[model samples]
Target: MDLYTFLYDLATGPLLWISFLTFIIGSLFRAGLYIMASRKMDKVTHEHFSLKYVFLGLVRWILPINRSVKKNPVFTILGYIFHICLIVVPIWYVGHISLWEDSRFGWTWTAIPDEWADYMTLTFLAIAVFFLLRRIFSKDIRLISTFSDYLLLVVTALPFLTGYFLSHGTLENVSFFGENMELIHMLCGELMLILIPFTKLSHFILFFFSRGATAVEFGRRGYSV
Candidate 1:
């Protein structure tokens, strides 16, 4: 009914504990793996590990030509929109707004305009699925996309599906603070957040290394990889 109730009920479950542990452990594993792989990649390529590339990649996330995804702008745009939606809606949701209120942000569960937030969340959910379909159906993408790539698409889609179900109150019995769909959604999402720092999704984190790998691989021949 109110913020207190939401917070009180939100804390009342193994969901939080399991989600937190999964997140923390998954994150550490993801980070460790990425670091090890990156180091290995650098040594193999005889390329120096530089934060400059990382920072540039972060900045370039806002731009179009990634040098990595440049060969496929349509897919890149779809991927970008989907990911941007993922970032925007979840952290800005009404549930998260509770934390903002308890803090000094002068915000609360009521802060985010619901329909707009819902739209942002759903828009990306649809686009993300579209991207997955494109990968499956498109001749070029299908040829190059790996099993891991398809798995990644599916993994990313699940949170959005549950999220859409939650956002739209589409479940049989919708209760944001209850130990129901919201809890399941939260757990799955936390798993994603935790896995992010470790998986090929870490490619999102290591865009520079990814780009630079291509850049250098082709730069030697005077072309962008």
Candidate 2:
């Protein structure tokens, strides 16, 4: 096969399946581990469990006036924007919905206009850069940052940057990476998928459990949390 066809096949075929399986299995395995570990802690803190407080605690975090959000308004706002764009662009962009329709199910949803998606993508990229710089220059964050932290930042940014270039035909205009630019962009996305459960990205999944524990503890104190 020629270059474009070969790259297309790789992106849409085997690599897609491999990456998806990795993401699914890895996520389940990590979640299982968290569940098992939480059991031991549950034994000790069983009295702390309160269904009412669990939901209340989660609601407290969702509110903008929560202590954490209040402590870092700028970070919280940018972080929420970044996450919104990150999720909306990929899932709702025309190109992506088409791909998902073809690959996963014969269903497609309305897509965000390309122009708006482009702006959102840029915003997410900018926020990602800010996060990386914060990790590097902020003393407290720097103290806790690890190599994986840096790697996560890079991996997270790669797809957004490459996708922007791909959409704008920047790579094609320069003949950058020959005809493989789209493939590279797709690979970066798949790499991110595969890393989600194994890396700090797992926090997305574990957030609920952590917040529930905190809520239980704090709710018992008779505060809004």
Candidate 3:
């Protein structure tokens, strides 16, 4: 009947089920395709670990995933910070932290607390937004930016902004718009989870594509080998 009740319903009922199913299906589909594609690509015996790097079955991902981006240390580190915070904060937030603690490897983390969560979320969201805007407004990035690239950022960013505002009760009160903001935020969040494994965001899950691609191209061209 009210905003909180509406959001509570979406968060608890249909959206949760749909989100879970979508995540499962989407993850499997993306991982399956990536495996098949990597296998199809010509192999190099010189490849380290003697594996197809299925889903970027590489060492960087095996580690901190920032190794491959060493060429640009600042950007890479910031990227890592942004990603870890983006993921860790939400999972550890008061809203989801208990479920995560119960269901996920007995894992526990210190959350930023509610108001601070809003602050951190807004700060990180701003950084991500700035990065996206930088890519958009710059001539070089604009040229290199694919439609999927921009689209991915759009999908990823909207939830962050909306959720941050919702959590803060700033731009959109928890009771506003029939609780549409919360539903919109949760649905977008679900969409992002379902979409992540398939998109370039998959890079986080599969950085080996870039490394393997780089290795093959360079070796074939007699460049960096």
Best by TM-score: 2
RMSD after CA superposition, every candidate? 5.8, 2.1, 4.9
Off by over 4 Å in 2: 1-7
- The per-model lDDT (C-alpha) reads 0.66, 0.85, 0.67
Clashes of each: 1, 0, 0
TM-score for model 2?
Answer: 0.90
Q: Write the per-residue lDDT of candidate 2 for residues 1-225, one digit (tens) a residue.
A: 887788789877998998889888988888889878887876644567898888887787766657778788999989889888988988899988888788657888999999999999999999999999999999999999999999998998899999998888776756656467788899999999989998889887788777887777777777775
Over 1-225, each residue of candidate 3 has an lDDT whose tens digit, in order, gives: 986687678776777777778767776677667667766674552343223343333444444653456676666766766777687667768766665677535666776677766766777787788778878898988998899988888887777787776666665544554346666777778788777776787765455555655545554555542
Sum up the clashes in candidate 3: 0
Worst 10 residues of 3 by lDDT: 45-54
Least accurate 10 contiguous residues by lDDT in model 2: 171-180
TM-scores of the candidates are 0.67, 0.90, 0.70
Q: Is candidate 2 or candidate 3 better by lDDT?
A: 2
Cα lDDT for residue 219, model 2?
Answer: 78
**Per-residue alpha-carbon lDDT of candidate 1 for residues 51-153, written as tens digits (9 for 90 to 100):** 5444554556557756547687777877777877777777777766764676554665444577877787778877877878888888988999989888877
